[model samples]
Target chain A: MAEMNRFTRDHEWARRDGELVRVGISDYAQDALGDIVFVELPQPGRRVAAGEAVAEVESTKTVSSVMAPVAGEVVEVNAALASQPETINRDPFAAGWLFALRPVRVAELDDLLDETEYRKYVEELSR
Target chain B: MLRTPLFGAHEHLKARLTEFAGWEMPLSYSGVAAEHRAVRESSGVFDLCHMGRLVLEGTGVAPVLERLAPSRIATLRPGRARYTVILNGDGGIVDDVIVTRESDTRYHLCVNAVNRERVVDLLRKTADGGDTRVADLTLETAQIAVQGPDSAELVRPLLAGADFPAYMHTVRGEWEGQEIVVSRTGYTGELGVELFLPAAAAPSLWQRLVEEAVPCGLGARDTLRLEAGYPLYGHELTESVTPVAAGIGWVVDWSRSDLPARARLERDRKAPEQLLCGFSLSAPGVPRDGFPVFLDGRSVGVVTSGNMGISVGHGIGMTWLPAAHTDPGNAIEIEIRGRRIPAVVEQPPFYTRGTVRQSVD
Candidate 1:
């Protein structure tokens, strides 16, 4: 079976792929943000701690930070976002993945909520 | 947060609501980009009840308004409207407004929402010893705008007998057996009309318009106005920014002998230190308010308002630059998020394909 995705309260999602982890904002977050105009990603090799802001997403109305779900060093970023940021709004998963990271502590993944729990959290937020 | 008369309509449309000027207003119904394109291409409707409306009447009303506003009111004929600015004694702008001459003795003033109370107090104080009476009609009235290339067609069916008002004109007419005041004026750079009716009638009227026009929200309104190069009161026309520096000096009636702020405006007109100019970013990043503008790596000014203009297909903004650098084609740079992006000074309306001045039969 494929790796299951986990989410943070800040709306970031992380999915392990072999030795690296792929991260991006959840669909719920992108819909709330309206349209994504620009995305500023962290440079490769930059280390980030859990809950630390690793990227900035600007919409027509406002700008919001995308926090890291787990402590890791960025290994690769979505270069295509600089030219077309709306991909995130169109598809918040798969092709719109923000970056790949090598986690400092693999056990930190357990701290994030599972997909089922994330759905519940988002439903409660809408209330 | 305060809700407008059409709050139920917005809720029914499943619009995303945001607090603006203490009112719970729609930020977007479908999406900002889609709503913006709808206005540019066809038709869009907006709920503008958050804007303040006030009426001043009596024989002395014209003179009282003339004394308080930078624009000459005595020359405005009935059924006509003039976009003017209210100014402080020191020549700073209090609010940018559209004053419509309803009759020889009565005038309707449309002021910004945030500055509503301040404008009302100023008008009341100026009319203190005169026969003029000021009344705040904001809460009792509801306002909506239908804008785009097809605006006239979209609104004509609803208007019973009164002809569509000419541009910059107002006409009173009956719609669905209720009276309303329609003005051929709007913030978007499109052929449009604004309807003012009883607060209770707003929801139904909104539903009628939305059936034919896209329901736009504040997000689209901002982008549309930015493309038109119109200034928002708080962003571009602050208490400290004069109309001269804001590039709205033409609104001042210099020929009027008794106009307020004339002397100061005249002085600034001769040598405006900083004036508003438009910039189109050649780089990728979007410029935002308060972003530092540079020339030759030295900071020269700051952006007053900026956005990714959907019609222009690039980042465009207005900035208060030194008068020396206001010429179109001048090279400039805006620092957005620690990146100095290349930009060029340009004249506005940034998007020229608008139908604002299209002739109506």
Candidate 2:
């Protein structure tokens, strides 16, 4: 309803699209992940609650789970990113969209902080 | 916190810090997986100054070590090094060390830093043969290992393209107005070199090499050794352990006729109750130290070293399996966080891809 950008403290981002929101990991998340070598995405049309583990991305040395940003139904998947996941490192904003969701509630995304607050959240994590 | 001579250089390079065996050392700056892959594909540099070095001098140095160690030491030629274990009276291991014959009657032995105090105590007790003198020189000396497939090529620049010779061999080289003993040896299972130099010269040499090549840290060092199946002390060895149990009896010279007084231990040559073997998980689970290993639903062994093998692309570990379950190719399970994960047994020297032995074969 307001600005389209919403971010999670864990460094995930969700963008409002009609009744749906497209979700993916943030640049800070990728930097911490170091070169991602594998991705296990959530199945399309599956229902996921907020904070639920929706997917997993493993770099060469670390294996981390991606949490859902808001309660939602998986609408579409980035099947191409599974084969060319380095896109997450190259063009994280565009080619790295991990998944799309038909949000169960529009107001829940507002609970996520804005970009500036998200930046501070990540800065704390680095320390 | 005791700092190595290269400590300032590590900070200058923006290296990530971690606590390892009571020393603050660089875990990585170029990233763990990146540095690991560099060692596999080319070369990487490591600051290993925390290791302890002890020099023994006198007429009976060889005779004293003959009784103190599990192997015969008199056979080592001048400038040659041999790996052996300093065993306690009951045949239990104290520490596995590399003793270099510096001269006909002098020796330079490298011991584990964490075990330095205890090792020195043992050395003092065993050095009472009347003619032997032991000097703890760890604080004055430092060591660095430059390892990988292209390590010889990179080190050639310093030595004018001279070959590293063979394992357990050392060559004298001069750098930064310092005389350094360059050894054609390393913990990583690759064609590598170890430089023993004064502590002050360590930082400059570390930066100079990394400025022109790759700067690695403890993370790469651990993973590279794991990939090579070389056992870390805390992981695969301890005071109560024996070399035969860990699968390193090859250094014991069991068949030599001139066996020292320590040869009395061979009477009970039955391998220990637990056997050390290589293991890889069936799934994506990290089996850390102290994780119990099982066979047919019963606990039979424990993981001593575990991590993701970046070069081979799998989760790997070293485990002390009961001799009954120690056969290679056998299936075992590691209990990671209360979950039993499947693993396969493998022989040692795990990642043999770019090792020096590969060249001869």
- Find the 10 residues in a row with the least total lDDT in model 1 chain B: B156-165
Where model 1 places Cα greater than 4 Å from the true spot, the runs are A42-52, A70-76, A102-108
Query: What is the DockQ score of candidate 2, to 2 decimals?
Result: 0.28
DockQ of 1: 0.67
Cα-based RMSD of the predictions, in order? 2.2, 3.6
lDDT (10s digit) by residue, model 2, range B207-275: 778865688888788888898898888778876667777778776777656444344346435635677
TM-score of chain A of each: 0.97, 0.92
DockQ of each: 0.67, 0.28
Docking class of 1: medium
Return the lDDT, model 1, position B35: 91
Q: Mind giving the per-residue lDDT tens digits that candidate 1 earns over A1-127?
A: 9999999999999999888889999999899888888888999999999889999888887788888888999999999998788899998988788998899987789989999999999999989
Error of 1 at A92 (Å): 0.7
Task: Report model 1's TM-score to 2 decimal places.
Answer: 0.93
